[model samples]
Target: WLRAGGIQGRAILLDYASWATAHSIPLSPFTSQPIPLAHLRQLIAERSITIRRGDILLLRTGLDAALKRLAPAEQRAISTRSSPDFIGLEAGRATLRWVWEQGFSAVASDAPSFERGPVLGDHADAEHTLHQWLLAGWGMPIGELFDLEGLAEYCAAEGRWSCFFSSVPLKVPGGVASPPNAVAIL
Candidate 1:
C-alpha cells in the first residue's frame, strides 16, 4: 500500500461539528459520542452532496478543536484513563453495512479512532465495529487523529466540502499501522 502511489481520491467532508452546533446538539470528544449513519446521511442530504465510489470519507467530530482547548491536566487525565473513551463513528452491523454500500476507499476522522474507542463494554456489537471489520475483514485503511479543524475552517469559508485527498503511509513492511503524511487539496 505504501509503495503503490498511496491513496488518492475524491474526498468528502461531513462537518459533524458544524451540524451539531447549528442544531444545538452537545458533543464531547472525551465522551462516547457516536456519529450515527443516519446523521451522516442527513448531512449528505442537507448539503446536497453526491456519494461516489472510491471516495475518501472525512468525518470531523470536533475532537481536534476540543482537545486544543483543554489544559495540560485535563489532557493528561484523558490519556491516563483506565478505559479511555472518546467520540467516534458509531459501531454496529448497521454501520458496517452502510460503509460497505457506500464503497468508500477509506475513512478518516479527527477523533482518536475511526470507530469509538474502548470498544470492550460501551458499544453494542463491539465485535462488528469498524476497527475489526475494516482492518481485519476488508483490509481497509482507517485514518485517525487527523487535524481536520483547518480543513473545516477552509471548507466552511469557501462553502466547498469536496477535495482531492492523498496520503502515503510510512514504508514499514508488515506494519499494522503507520502515521500518514496526508494532504487535501481544495
Candidate 2:
C-alpha cells in the first residue's frame, strides 16, 4: 500500500463472516447478530477508533461451508449478483449510517453479499441496497469473500493494528462485484 500512499500505518480490517443454518435462519449480519451495527459502533467508539471515508473495513462471516456445498456452476451463477447472501435494505441503510459515522470509505466481507439472505418484506432489494449504499452512497468500494482469519491471527500475535492492504479485481464492465485476489502484507 505504500506504493499507493496508504501505508502511513493506520489501516484496520474488520471481519464479516457469518454462517447460515441448514434451515433458513436469517443469514445477514445486520439481523442475526446479538451485537448489531449500533453495538459495533459503540465498541469502536469506545476504543477511540475512527472510521472515515476511503478507509478499508474488513468483515468476516463464516459462510465458506455453504460456498463449498454449491456446485461450481451454481457458484458462478450466484457471483453475478453483488453478494451471495441477502442483506435487507433497511439493514443496509443502518449499516451505511454506522459506516459513515465511523469514517469508513471502503468495506470488505467474507460472505458473498454484505446483506442478509432470503431477504423478506418490501425490502426485496437487499443486495441492491447494500451495493448502492456503500458504493454510491458512501463512495466506498467493497471487497467480497476475503480470507481474513489467518492474517487477523497474525496481527493479534504481533500486537499491531496497521498493515498494507491490496486487492486486484477483474476489469469487467457493468459488473456489480469483481472476483478479486486480495492480500494484506504486514
Candidate 3:
C-alpha cells in the first residue's frame, strides 16, 4: 500500500539495541538481536557511505524490555527521566562523536536519554550532554524508541540501501520527542 503511494525503494536498515530482547522477554526475536555499534560503523565505512547532515540516526538499546518490567507508576516516572542503569557519559560522548562524525542530523536510542542513567554511575551527573551536543549544538532532533524489526527484515531480504521515511507527530507544542508512529517503505 505504501509502495503504491510511491514509497518503494532500496535501503540499508539498522536495528538498534532492544531492551526487551536483551532482557529475554521473547516479545520479538529480531528485537532481541544485537548489532554492535562498531559493526554498524564498519558497514558505513566499508560502503564509503556518509550519513548526510539531517539524516535520521536511530539507536536501539533494548531498554523497552526493562521499561516493560516496571510498574505503571514507575513507567510514568521514567517516561520523562531515565533510570541510572542506562549507558554512561563516556560511552554516550563516544557514541555522540561517532554519530556527529558520520554527519547525522539526529541520533536516537530506545533508552530514554543518550547518556546512562544516574543510578548506574556518576559520569552522567551532568544534565544530558548528549542532548546539548546533538540538539543544541548540531540542531538535530533525536527520535526515540522506534519499532524497527519489521523494517529491518525487509531491508535484509532485498539488500536495499535507502528508503523514503514518513512520519506524523502530535501537534503538541514544545514537544521534545514523540513516540514514533513512523515507517520506511521498501
Ranking by lDDT: 1, 2, 3
Please give the lDDT score for candidate 3: 0.50
* TM-score per candidate: 0.95, 0.61, 0.58
Give all candidates' CA lDDT scores: 0.87, 0.54, 0.50
Best by TM-score: 1
Question: Candidate 3: where are CA atoms >4 Å away?
Answer: 1-12, 16-39, 43-50, 63-84, 87-94, 118-120, 125-128
Pairs that collide in candidate 1 are none
lDDT of 1 by residue, 1-186 (tens): 567878998999999989888878899778877778888888888888888999999999998899989999988888899876888888999999999999998999998888777665746586687888988899888999889998999998998889999998887877777887999998
Give lDDT for model 1: 0.87
Please report the TM-score between candidate 2 and the true structure.
0.61
Instruction: Give the 10-residue window scoring lowest on summed lDDT in candidate 1.
Output: 118-127
Cα RMSD for candidate 3? 7.5
